[model samples]
Target: MALPYGFVKAKIVSTPQLKSTRRPHEVQYHLHFGITVNGAPWDIAVNVGTTDADDLLKYQLVFDFRHSVLTTLKSTSPGSTDLTGTDALPALDFLRSDFLAKTGAWRNSDVMDGSDQVEPVASLQRLLLRAQQSSLDVYVFGRFYSEGDGVHDVHMNQGSRGEFIHHAGDDSNDHNDIWQDGALLVDLGEPEWALYAAAFDQQYVPTDDLGNPAPGSQPIS
Candidate 1:
């Protein structure tokens, strides 16, 4: 399950801040960016992180979710999951946890040893830099707070259970399928724009949300 909106074609407006936080019942790394949509001020948390799992250093970069929209790649990923980008994609279109690991362009030499937090941050810095100057279409699930409103779940959001299943919230206003979520589309004008999708846990939410795990109990699986 994901936000009612599909994605926001956006531009990164400033230098983003990278941060790791242990807030409430979860741990996450957030890339906070300031953005403007049609000259209207808005912020984007171009985030990729984990929850309940210590594997924060591992992430995948899907270099072709929308690449087929421009070029002729025989196959964008493994199996029948052809990321040809033939039409406007919804977040639910990508729901596999192993989508990037199996299909995206990541080198074996790029693996980060599970020792510290440098791996994801280093890679993200480069990606954010690419996004700073290049035009980007941030595919997202919308989340709104009183102080702000922005797209979240900038990662994969399927293969989930319990309250984390995005459909658990706002039934009438959400995508009802079991598998669906968010991602990013980067345009380089090279006839091959790239898309990167990530996932943490669909069960993780704000302290007040209905799906959030109960206090002092186990976090969502």
Candidate 2:
């Protein structure tokens, strides 16, 4: 089974940092942003596309994610909350829920044009910066650390394949689960909240209840 899937309701406390711990020829890049949950330091790790001239799997980005879950999230307490059981907290499911609209809504190309052609990193940074400037609370939907002070996998957690599919000796994808998708939502005040979501290029939509890709599954183009 996957780790405890949940969300962290907090406020941005510091500027975002672009960090990479991968070795040469490896493409593991993340945007590490800082937030304070109930006066404690917490990290938000968001995956981004690589600028390296490699043919690794690129990441897909989506902004302005809309869902009724935001209404419930706004009422949650400040700190880490486990959304594992049947509760009022709405769990995110990228393929099963209406978190996003049509397939074309996914942005995998240039987010900006001309001189302002910023990568996913810069675009996410600007979003966080705006939230910080507005002093809004950030609701991070993902798996909370079981041993540390942070939340990772803030992206689409379904339709996983290959190495991402956790093998439990019997080749079963233990990591696959419904209603545990990850995303980030910033409360931009009444009727206006900015959301940030991402997914790997290899991941496909129309996942099954087990979170596995169903027949005719297609990637967001």
Candidate 3:
């Protein structure tokens, strides 16, 4: 199934939920949401877990939307992109923090929930709390259904080489052709804001979209 690239400006319609499946063979963590837009209803989820692609890289980035965070984001991701969610954002186009500082891992010292389960949702509540002040600009790739409705793959879309994820090529003929990037932007107030971007390292080009590749797509072998 191919999910197109998209970005939506929306507000939280209800309380978000975090669910994790830790069965050895089916291990993964999910954060789901009920999103409210002026004209449409949307369902979005962020999916990340373990795989043999290279190493375990599950993480969540949260920002406080302070003046300092805003300055960094603007200086880093100054480029304006279409919300179609079809673009790949290079590191220069976004903020890149130290692993320990950005990771929401309990072992990594992230602020954890009271449950403190193995796969915990740290910093999630902290960030969503900020959204209470205003609508969030969510970047996503939506899949429209036959009934003119749909859900969104509201997470990082590139870098997974698994054939199951359609990461190998851009042949539209193939149903598995949805490779993209997404993020959440918060407008704290005039000049203060933040962006939460998730991504994987296995991608050849984080900024490449369908029929387009980032300025550099070659690798050194």
Most accurate candidate by lDDT: 2
Instruction: Give each model a TM-score.
Output: 0.59, 0.80, 0.54
lDDT of each: 0.45, 0.68, 0.42
- Model 3: residue 125 alpha-carbon error in angstroms: 2.2
The clash numbers for all candidates, in the given order, read 6, 0, 4
Residue pairs that clash (backbone atoms under 3 angstroms), model 3: 5-84, 6-84, 6-85, 88-207
lDDT pick, better of 2 and 3: 2
Ranking by TM-score: 2, 1, 3
Can you give the lDDT of residue 118 in candidate 3? 32
List, residue by residue over 3-28, the lDDT tens digit for candidate 2. Answer: 57788888888877767655464545
Worst 10 residues of 1 by lDDT: 77-86
Ranking by lDDT: 2, 1, 3
lDDT of 3 by residue, 1-221 (tens): 34444444556655656655564443445466666555566565654333333433334454443323334344433122233333233211222223224434322222223232333254654555557435554433333322434343344444344442354444343222333344566665565455554443344443333322345653211
lDDT of 2: 0.68
Q: Which stretches of candidate 2 lie over 4 Å from their true place?
A: 23-25, 51-66, 85-89, 102-104, 109-117, 166-174
* TM-score attained by model 1: 0.59
